[model samples]
Target: MGAFTRPFFIGFRRINTYSLHSMRQFVLFIVLITGLVTGKSAYAQWEFYGAGGVRYATTEEIDTNGKPLVKEHGFLPGLEFKANYRRGDWLVTLGGEIYGGNLVYDGQTQSGTTFSTDTRTRQFRMTTEVGRYVSDAVLLLAGTEWDYWKRDILGRGTTLGMEEEYNSWRFLAGAQTRVLQASWSDIYLTGLLVVSSPEHLEVNFDNQVFDQANLSTKAAIGARFALEVRPKAYSNVSVESDFEWMRIGRSGDAILSKGGSPVGTVAQPEHVRKAIGIKIKYRF
Candidate 1:
């Protein structure tokens, strides 16, 4: 509840601009599904929850001109919403999240001059999954995930600012296991593996352009766990603490361009992202 709150609000506000009509349709679809389920059964299995968390991206080092370089680290504040529906042994899950942060980049010039710039970063992800319970406490799922990222670098002196954007997709498979269950509390652990591909990646350096040339598919690995406590019977209210970790692959190719000609290529560093926080949820 400091400077990060500003970006948290900004991220949610920008969601419509990011997906527009698609998001509206998605929300309506979920509403319709919820209505149908409630109308059909009194013991309906449906859950809607929202969470807020803090996240950190691993440090990265990148090269620049004249033996100069930069190292970046990102601290993000995030919010997420998830919906789940279960009938018999089959379950469907839909979720989305937004993260916004300032990426601190420390740079060193060839002449040994050092400086830092705070680059703004905004990211969003959507996920859908279909799963079946293999046992009372174990579930296996497969899903598709999509991510969008944007970064803005502030100009310093004669250096022109840059805006970078990326769209990515992943096919994922995962399993969830309940580690502990009590009358009023529960614990769950989940692990996932994904094959990720970049749909688009580009950089606009004050109008000069750099685009992805030949991108490579990469693997992403993730895990998350949650502990929840319910306060009363027949009540959907609960408080939970969630922990998650993800290791993502490289940032793909960035082909430098000048006057409509390819000049050089840029190398990007890999990323490891992690988040942990407490959230309150209500199941319906």
Candidate 2:
């Protein structure tokens, strides 16, 4: 009886040892998998950029009769900042810009009266985008943007100053690709198709009797193009040039209000804007 009991205890000990060894191997496998996942996640990084540049912008508005009403053109100084986060094949970007300056305004009233003035202009823009890398050199992008613009027409002699404000939203789809690769520098090109909608315009007459008017415009399609160059020695610096064009359709007539009473009807005419800009950017 003692021999049989001793052999039974020995068998139990051997089985316990085998179970411990297998459990250790399983724990080791789990640790290795967790480390690999953590290492892959650690590869995600953020990049920031700041830029200053000059933009040349031009805008033209036509009346309902297809007669030109006003044209404004100027060179505006601007500053922009951007941030990007990249993880594996996905990228996210956010950016904003502001531009302000005095512009030359030429206008002709319905009575064939022509006048010119210096208009104080300011523009603000915000953008967000998501991109996916399809290849080493190509990326596809989708984005949305918000834009605000204001113009203050300075009074000339007896005329009173007037103020105009515009708000617009846009959705965009784009593609970017590396066009040239060299030892010192690389060049990239991008093109975007944009759709603008839910645009609003407000006009203040600066008169006690007339007050203000608000109008909503039709949607439009636009496009943007950009070219960028980066130097290998200065990986954190780049130069970019871009062009954009957009048109806003005519708005339905709206009632102009004075106090609590309706004074008259006002409508925003069709307008087109074009801009070209260049900037040097520093990234970190």
RMSD of each: 7.1, 25.9
1-284: candidate 2 lDDT, tens digit per residue = 00001101000101224234434643554454345445654544866677999999998888778767889899999888776778899999877777889988787543455667777887877788999999989999999998778777765544445666777889999999999999999999999999998688766664433555678899999999999999999998999999999988888988866786876676777888899999999974
Best-matching candidate per lDDT: 2
After superposing candidate 2 on the true structure, give the runs of residues whose Cα lies further than 4 Å from its correct spot.
1-44
**Global Cα lDDT for candidate 2:** 0.75
Show the colliding residue pairs in model 2.
Answer: none
Off by over 4 Å in 1: 1-45, 62-71, 107-113, 207-235, 239-254
Clashes of each: 0, 0
lDDT by residue for model 1 over 106-149, one digit each (tens)?
65433345645667877788889999999999999899988776
Q: For residue 164, give model 1's deviation from the true position in Å.
A: 1.5
